[model samples]
Target: MKKIEVVAAIIQHDDKTLCVQRGPAKFDYIHHKFEFPGGKVESGETGEQAIIRELQEELRLDISKADYFMTVDHTYPDFHITMHGYICPVESREIVLTEHIDAQWLSINELPQLDWAAADIPFVEKLMAE
Candidate 1:
């Protein structure tokens, strides 16, 4: 089995967290699931670098800083992922959605109401506790 290592940006503003829906999935289980926007940590890049790059490419938002939050290791049916999460506050700019199908800034209490990727559930749970 292949292991995927990635970083997720838990971007927040004014007490709300940004969540984006996956653009499309060939697999039914993953389609439309809400998630923090981010991408894989390419070789030779730190988690911080990865999230910064991913956000810029995926959302067109500049991450001023990414503070470490939590890490999640999850095994799906076909792959496993070790994900590093960071609490990223963006620079003042409008978000341009480039990859996700939809996005919403939801209250922490409402975070769990939407369908989320299996790997992101623990991160969301941990966030709600804060």
Candidate 2:
């Protein structure tokens, strides 16, 4: 089993949060599922750094700061993941979708309506509970 570490950003703009949809995947469980924007944490980079870099790379969106949130550990049939979540407030909702196939800005209450990646569901539940 391969274990991976990643970071995710709950990017808030005004009253909505950004949600990105994956294009496709080898596994049906995650294919086209919605997820917060972020990616694998590179060597020597903090969770914050990884998130900032990921957002910039994947969305062409720049974020000035990231506040620590919570972490979720999940295991899938093919891999295990330890994901760090962050609360990142952005001034603009504008983004260039370089990787994902779709993007939406939905309020916290409306988050659960979308089909989400398994690891990302915990984050959605937490946000909706707030």
Candidate 3:
């Protein structure tokens, strides 16, 4: 199976982490699934660059500082994906969402409150264990 490589920003503020729910714009089984804000790394772009670009486009926010977290590989019924997770620190709690249906600032303890995208579950588990 072919693999799709992506990057994600686990943007956190204080004790709250930023999570986004996919909008109707996404496809079946993918849409409405909760996830960190980010997207696929385009050709010629580094994973860091991709997350930075995706953040600007999706949330209209900037991540001035970020720390590498972990990489996870996941296979869904339809496709396989590799995700690079980063802990992105932003200057503001404000965001303007253009792609997602909804956004939330939830504590790590609340991470399991919503249904998450399959691939993101591993990272979530890793996060809470920290």
Quote each prediction's TM-score.
0.95, 0.98, 0.94
lDDT per residue as tens, model 1, 1-130: 8899999999988778899999688867778899988989999999999999999999989877999999999998888989999998754536999989998998899999989999999989998887
- On lDDT, the stronger of 1 and 2 is 2
lDDT of 2 by residue, 4-101 (tens): 99999999999999999999889898999999989999999999889989999999999998998899999999999999999999999999999999
In every candidate, how many clashes are there?
0, 0, 0
Q: Which run of 10 residues does model 1 get worst, by summed lDDT?
A: 88-97
lDDT of 3 at 39: 89
lDDT of each candidate versus the true structure: 0.90, 0.95, 0.90
Local error of candidate 1 at 9, Å? 0.5
Name the runs in model 3 displaced over 4 angstroms: none
- Which prediction has the highest TM-score against the true structure? 2
Q: Where does candidate 2 stray beyond 4 Å?
A: none
lDDT per residue as tens, model 3, 1-130: 7789999999998888999999874357777899998889999998889999999999999888768899999887777999999999776799998999899999999999888998899888998999
Error of 2 at 95 (Å): 0.2
Candidate 2 lDDT at 44 equals: 100
TM-score of 2: 0.98
